[model samples]
Target: MSTFQERYAASVMNTFGPPKLVLVKGEGAHVWDVDGNEYVDLLGGIAVNALGHGHPALVEAVSAQLQTLGHVSNFFTTPQQVELAEKLLELIGADAGGGKVFFTNSGTEANEAAFKLTRRTGRTHVVVAEQSFHGRTMGALALTSKEAYRAPFEPLPGDVTFVPFGDVDALAAAVTDRTAAILLEPIQGEAGVNVLPDGFLATARAIADEHGALLWLDEVQSGMGRTGEWFAHLPSGVTPDVVTVAKGLGGGFPIGACIALGPAGELLQPGNHGTTFGGNPVACAAALAVIRTIEEQDLLEHVSVLGQKLRDGLVADPRVTEVRGEGLLIGLDLAEERSAEVAAAALKSGFIINNATPQRIRLAPPLVLTDDDAKAFLAAWPAILDEAF
Candidate 1:
């Protein structure tokens, strides 16, 4: 093993298994390992590196903020922190009616804050969708439905129910007046980019309203222009009471937000929850840079156009049975259960992909990925599939 790999194994926890490569440098959508091998990064740090690696805008923003003032603690807020909060509210369309934001260091912390906020509504039960992945923390884990992740962590917080995803009847039956919130992800990223059925989000919104419960959409993996929109649930025209976002928010910096709208915004009072490094100046500055770059570069339009092209090209091969998801967050099913083999083959051929399941391949490349890079991958895809299959 390489020196770095051996050192990593000795020092780091094994929660994520072994490191795939000892990466040394990156630019745009490509990365180079210590051995000097170049490869296109299709996963984009699991959808967190929105601007890709070492983008000038992100680097400069973080550097400038750190040089000025870094962490001020939650007792006092910095201008960057307030500006980012306002920008998030503006993007979420909550500025008009006014909203509140609680910052965290990651998606899991954001969800944890929102989870606690739901308890203030005097309802303990929460209705969540099956196959949903909120986070690994105890509070967030209670909302996740995967058996394997929850089995070992028994005695989790109670009063949580899981309904089949996209099943309107099941959702309607599961929610009641006693429910505190209805949490769902418009695009189920961990479950192989499973998009919600048409009108499913609208139905969820209605159910929450009828039962007087909050509608919380966890947009951690699909927000921040990942689905060609600010948030994936925007197109549904269903305004959620609470939204949790992280992943691509900071373009690589650690930042997350739990935004509550209207009356739901007042649920978490002073001293309800707090975090030390959640909305530090540097993190907020990094997020602001990501948002500005996306707007200036018009990456949303680019993502929409290129995503369609990549999806069309990927399905051309007969081995690909189906393709799902939006923008750069794409997932495909193979004719056989060889996704792991396919991903390994892709890496060997100078590409990086994710095996979301035994038969599912997920691609969440950087939004800044160029047309030439995509074309190169398309050209090499057939051979990669052949070697794997």
Candidate 2:
């Protein structure tokens, strides 16, 4: 009989390519392959496992909520759904009564909701930064700057312009009277964790304000304390009109949210947008548990300290050309274009990492990552580089 990997290759679409290792179980920051070989999961499922795998709190919350109320149509609401929305608003520092939330099952859907919200401004034009990734859906695809991802699905909803990321002048030049919103990622995660230049986000906010456009930030990868803060843009001190978040929000169970502040919150009326399972009770409960776990455990502070250690350790090797990022969202430049080889070497060395580009290695480990696991990866770094190069 064919193995699971062989079956996967035959049945699954070629979207993500072949599987690396067939993982069977996980706990905290570590996972076990089907053969029982252990591996430290530094990628944390691309930053979605904030509390890591099999956390008791998350498991218990999901179980309890599922038993009580698995799901309900949008025509009705659950207490968990309303509570999660209020909690999210509080965490985002927008609990001032004017902020509103539209929940979805994934980040792309969250962006879709925000996309429709932008259209309600009576302006079709939008200014997006180059190398920005909003989502894969058509509406979000139109705002995305990558040609490869957008080319296959052309005739995308138009009226969107791409400007150079981190260029204040380009952003200022891009927005016009017809611009509905200025959408950006606090740090471009898919483009290899490209952090914005200092004052870049503040400049975008000013430009949007000057043009009477909404400032929308895609925090799908950088929010929920990933950067040792509630949102990556917090350091910029600019409150955006719209913020799209997901990834780690539910800690594994899928959930996404698009938050709009002030008058922007009122743009989406009853008929504008709707989803059948956007705010299901179980998903909301899981999200609440994730958020509460972060607060109770003070994982944000841990991420800040541990991330700095990891970044410094990775860049100490001469083969590492440079390192950039904040908190746990780290990206490094290798001296050679051998990131895929490096990833393979890491896996063989009993760790999991990601190669976002030919020479860029991205690391977004769980916020609850242990010091010992981090130290072990650091110890393996030089050997991994030596083997890859």
Candidate 3:
């Protein structure tokens, strides 16, 4: 093994099996291994690096915040913290002073906070969908429908029902008046970017209204301009009562938020939940910088244009059976179950992609990924497939 691999195996836990690469540095949508070899980073740190590596705005914001105030405990609050919260509500179009926010350190924490908030509705049961990945935390994992992940962590706060994703009837049948909330991902990121059917979110909203349940949409992986929209559910014209956002929210700084709208905002009392490093000034500054940079650089429009080009170009190859997802969050099915081989081949040839499943390849490149880099990948696509096949 390489020196870095040996050290990593000795020090880091094996939760994710083995490290794929000993990456030492990155800039834009590219990364360099410890051996000085470079690769185009199509995964974009699993959709977290909105501005990519070594972004000046992100670096400057973090540095400035640290220089001003390094940290703040939960008992205290900072201007950056409040500003970031307001900014998130504004971005989601919920800033009419009706939205409330709970900050967390990651997407899983955000979901966990939302989970506890649901319980305060005086209801115990929650309805989720099959093949949905909320997070790995205890509370979030309880809501996840994957047997493999759930089996290992048995009895994860029960009362969560799993329904067929994209099936409005099944969801409606499962939810009752006692149901605390109905949680869903706009696109199933871990299930290889499975796209929810058209109007599925809208149907979910109607069902939640009928059942007197909170409509909680987990936008952890699909939000923060990942879909070329502020939130994936916004286009459907459904205003969710609860929304969990993370991943790209901090542009790699590790920050998340659970936003509650309407009456759902008051579900959590003062002592309902708390965190030490959730909304620290540094983290908030990082998130604010990410948001501001996205607007100023027009990264949303760029992502929209580049994503279409990529999806269209990828599907043009016969080896790719289908492509799913919007904007930066993309997945494609191979003609056969060789996604691992394809991903390995791509990596060997200086590209980093994800083998999300046996037959699915996922790509969530940085929003700031340049047109030249995308075109380069497109030109190299046919050869990558050929080598893998």
Each prediction's whole-model lDDT (CA) = 0.95, 0.92, 0.93
lDDT of 1 at 184: 95
TM-score of each: 0.99, 0.98, 0.99
> Which lDDT tens digits does candidate 3 get at residues 321-345?
9999999999999999999999999
- In candidate 1, which residue pairs get closer than 3 Å at backbone N, Cα or C atoms, i.e. clash? none
Candidate 2 C-alpha error for residue 199, in Å: 1.1
The top-ranked prediction according to lDDT is 1
In candidate 3, what residue range of length 10 has the lowest lDDT sum?
89-98
- Segments of candidate 1 deviating more than 4 angstroms: 95-97
> Which has the better lDDT: candidate 1, or candidate 2?
1
The C-alpha RMSD in Å for every predicted model, in order, reads 0.8, 1.1, 0.8
Q: Is candidate 1 or candidate 3 better by lDDT?
A: 1
lDDT tens string, model 1, 330-356? 999999999999999999999999999
